[model samples]
Target chain A: MEQPHGPQQQRPPSSPPVPPAAGGPAAAAADAPHAAPRAPRRLSRRRLLKLGGLVAAAGGLGLYRCGLYDERLLPPGLRVLGRREAAIAAAVIETVLPPEPPPSPERVRTLLAAIDAYLLGLPAEQVEQLRWLLLGVEHGTFWFGARLERFTRLGARGRTDVLTGWQRSRLGLARAGLRGLVALVFLAHYRDAPAFAAIGYGGPLAPGFAGPPASAARYARLLAPPEREPGW
Target chain B: MIYTAEHVRRDRVLQADLCVIGSGAGGAPVAWEAARHGLRVVVLEAGSYLEPRHFTQIEYDMVQRLYHDGAARTTADRAIHVLQGKGVGGSTLHNLNLCKRLPEEIAAQWFADHGLAPLQGGTLPALFAELEQLLGVSELGPAQANANNRVLERGCRALGWRGGWLRHNRRGCVGAGFCELGCPFDAKQNALKVFIAEAVEAGALVLADTWAERLEHDRRRVRAVEAAVRDPRTGAVRHRVRIEARAVCAAASATGTPALLLRSAVPDPYRLVGSRLFLHPGTAVAGIFAEPIHGWRGIPQSYECTEWLDLGPQSTRRVWIVPSFAHPAGAAATLGAFGAEHARLMRDYAHMAALSPMVHDLVPGRVRPRGRFGVAIEYRLDPSDAAQLRLGLVAAARLLFAAGARRVLVPASPALELAREDEIEPVLGALSLRPHTLDLTSVHPMSGCWMGDDPARACCEATGRYHHLDNLWVADTSLFPGSLGVPPQLTTYALGLHVGRCLLAALG
Candidate 1:
């Protein structure tokens, strides 16, 4: 049976055979007639300097094209989603699953940028699908939030009845929207949060709820209202 | 003994009837049994003793300090992750404290086909009793389970998967969710906490920060073992030492043992050495729930589903869904590109539950020796194994959806998210099992330097003695000739105990 490809195949050959020298007896006699005339060597400091400058300029341009520089390289649609939609999504996610003391503005911005970068890197088809999914979520959350506010505005008995009714039909939709919203927010915030801690993940990776200022309670207050707010 | 004023000098040489190479699970119990029988015993360990205080909750640092290859070792062809631990306790130090014994059929096959004595009903029961008493293995109680494990239990029950609480070698665990990192509390009962400690207390000298380089022999009988001592942090060579032994036991795991033998040029013409390797590639399916599951607050993998074990030969599949957690770097790597969307996912961490299916792989691989003492493994899932992976993915997705998952993320390349429960099967069917598309990993790698009934197809005999060498023996998982269809640590330890006894009797 053929062996699976592994390190032995990937490593470069230990040693290559030495090539015959150009001026050896065999080469000199056999190719004497056809050998081209040797070119004269000259030192041109100005030319050398010009060549170095050109190489440096090319290298800088190459780095810029690789998305290493500050300016955005993605298409306008993607750039807009990264810059604007990401922030809005993060804010909305904070409201949906609020952490205590809420994330700082810088933290939220970092989160948005990370998520935007992540989404932008995806295949065009996936990005399109995700965009549609997010749009659906945005619409659902908007309606759900409006309905919730409307019900809260009613008298206590009225609020209770309306909530009980919505629980039957719209609860599933509301839950789905909340999940989408939370996922988007987490993907965004996790990029900026400490490497050990995560919002929704509790695998071997979660840093757990410890450390100094980044208390879970503080994060909750920052993201959502105190009562009935989701805390991760 | 070489000594100066700082070290006591003795011109005397103390000898043992049998000298085991490692003091981990495979070597520890054997040494204990041998020593208990009034045999002079010396157990050599390559790693130092790590106190409970040394165990940290830091992912990067702990993995570097505790895990072999610093947790970056992977198969070359596909990014199949591999993890092993190095230290006084071996892999038990870093493992998730899961214990499982091989099924009766598998044990019987070993006996019938390999000429090893059959581990019959009573024999296996006695072995289990000895193992349980020695390792303190027990099932996790409901009160000891965390919310995440409970969610797994609920999911398995909802899907009617044959699942049950997993037995772990732990005591007084506080649900720290840092088993992979190294439990901060001295709750995990790795070899260091139990066997190695007892061995040391019983006058076994363990040389830490040492590597057994090669085996030296006179004709067929082994004479001495050569090793090097170095600084653990810098890896700078400190000293070279040699221990003359009457016999040497190689318990260096499946990968390490064969590589060591190959490097030493101890000829076994069967070409079966370092072949027939099995890695149970596993993957996790993450589900987003409506409520906080607090997955990190409980036993890492308290419950498991054995529903798929008897899926039959044609199916070539087995799956168990267990609770799992991820550290930040691991989470970030899995989360892919980071930013606002990723951040949002992080915020809802409490509402997430990850279910992993550990599959039984039939496809075999090989481990080749490389540079100095290093090993390179090559493995590829065969067609049947690939089919099993698809089945496993479908099963995992169905269970997650049944457990009230609003959305589930599949770890396939171009990762897809399942929104509705109905989309699970179709999406799973569409997945490509090509190396690039799948995220595969294995914690249990076995059957490399395997034993067989005949000299033509095997590296060693039933007693783990190399066919060509009278005094050389293997006491590690490498001696397993085939897949056990379950975790092999307990079985490895039992085999070690059996072989150690046989070697002593033969010597006498």
Candidate 2:
């Protein structure tokens, strides 16, 4: 065995030790005058998942280069969801909603805007969980749906298939991930007034009452004055 | 008087005889009673103060404004949806106002099993009567049943199942059909419009948009309460508030109360603070009728069928059925389909009626504090409870069919669509009770910091006093020894009053 690098440099052993790198401890050992020949290494599940993650990230980067994930698509002053996450969310909205009469570009943007507004009210921890959920759904296509493309790149039928796979998967995480995204989509889509007209909902029951205010100034005006002054 | 984050310019301090952590059904009465006794009281509410004028009656907007976690708070595994409310009045701001007393059987069970004698005592009934008078609890006539409630009523009559109209805490209800989204017409006589108002009039200072961080305690005595007043739009901590009080009451709901206790690190040798959580988990069944049901037009839930509900600990049937409908957003999210199929179902929105079977679970779940102001709920359905729910689903389908529904849709994965009565049994019989297989939501989350004689098994005494800490008390549904197999708002109000008196005596 090789005695180079002063007794292997005391490196922590990997699960299945990484294949020797050039000028590394294992490589130094292999290249030693008395070292034995090395055998072929087999890949483990953990290693495969790491590799998948890198490959998915690379695929995402490639899609970004293609201008699919435009950060400017998100409106200014978004407190939570990132631009890439918003793009993925838009794709999800397109996939789950009715395809016969496709949603207009403006409608999709409105839904995304509503989600962004909604996320502003949640705690950062929950919003962080949501970001992780989006990442999993985007990169999990190969693992869950046996597709190599990211979620945003998966066309309508492919995306549908992937979502169906998650909905029926034995793993609870997969089912929950799909459910979280679908809930977000429905929440934004069905709240729009156009959706009401399509479904025959007569909107709010009150006559002179307006819906949610469009600006902060309007919301302030809507708040009623306090009943009495504070004792302090 | 009330204050929000906007009213505070910098970190401030207050000295009070009593400090209440919430302004809900539980905390409001306590504040009112204590303030009336000339005790300087300060109340901290985590949500913003939005009166009737602020209520938009829009599902998305109100859900974000009034509900806990934008009504997106669910179990850790995403198995069940938990709908808790935030705001000056807590859940009462958005609750349907269905007021039911704790079942007699449940009270007996608590006394027998948990040694909760006070719950089964004579004092509680008087408290209930008084609370009812104050809140104007009354029953709607049979004529008040809209097409949605009528479906349940007609079905119960046709099948000879026990059912009737329930009482509510509303004084000027206008059938706006937007009770779940706070009442825009100021119809609901909830804690906000009733007790909290009275408390403010009695000089209790309520600080909305204030989040309680921890109870500064010295082993047995809670010395002070530390909190942060957050900017409403950005959720940033704009001001800090510290209150030194003789006593502190935690009226944050089941989830909120337990999380607060755990965060405060109150002495609990048994680790019983956040354990024993029970969610009255429920799922709905939709029926499509030839006549337009227009289900979302009147009081959301007024009538209920109790054939399957018996509040005994060992009872076989444990589901309470009520007419459940949703606005467009909730409907699209709950219905079991997507794309063209879901769109087709939405077209029949006006012709659809719904019935939800809420289970009275026996097994307990848990709640843990996630961060400073967040909760992590871990709840899974017990097999027995799930079986009862399945049975309730079958019964709901039968009722809808009996009421002349053209087609009944059970909101299950591969949603069971039954056209005839014969199709109900075999279809739902084979349906699995797994998490993703059926859609479930819970409005009532109770009994996390439960009350009992055994300190090892309970978080508080029957009088809402914490055993480990003398000056700390939990006065919300967190004090329930077991699941209250009914809407718990009315009992919550009564218990709040009881705990207030207990604290008043302790202070004296």
* Candidate that would win on DockQ: 2
* DockQ, all models: 0.05, 0.30
Q: List fnat, each candidate.
A: 0.09, 0.44
Q: Per-residue lDDT for B1-508 in model 2, tens only? A: 7787777777889999999999999999999999998999999999998877677777777888798888888899888989999899999989988988878898888888789766666877999899889989999867677899999999999999999899988876778899998887777888876877767777788899999999999898999999999977668888789999999999999999999999999999999888888999999999999999999898989999999998876799899999999988788778746777678888899999999999999998999999888899998898998998898999999999999899998876545688888998898998888886777899999998889989887888888999999999889999988899999999899899999998999899
Off by over 4 Å in 2: A1-77, A143-146, A207-231, B117-120
* Per-candidate iRMSD: 19.9, 5.2
lDDT of 2 by residue, A1-232 (tens): 3443433445556545555566768667665768754444568899999999999999987765444674434556665777788877777777778776887777778788888888898778778888888777777888768998888888888887777777677876666666667667777776656777888888878744643333233334323354432336
Q: What is the TM-score of chain A in candidate 2?
A: 0.64
Give the TM-score of each candidate.
Answer: 0.70, 0.89
Estimate every model's Cα lDDT from 0 to 1. Answer: 0.63, 0.84
- Once superposed on the true structure, which residue ranges of model 1 sit more than 4 Å away at CA? A1-232, B1-17, B38-40, B118-121, B311-315
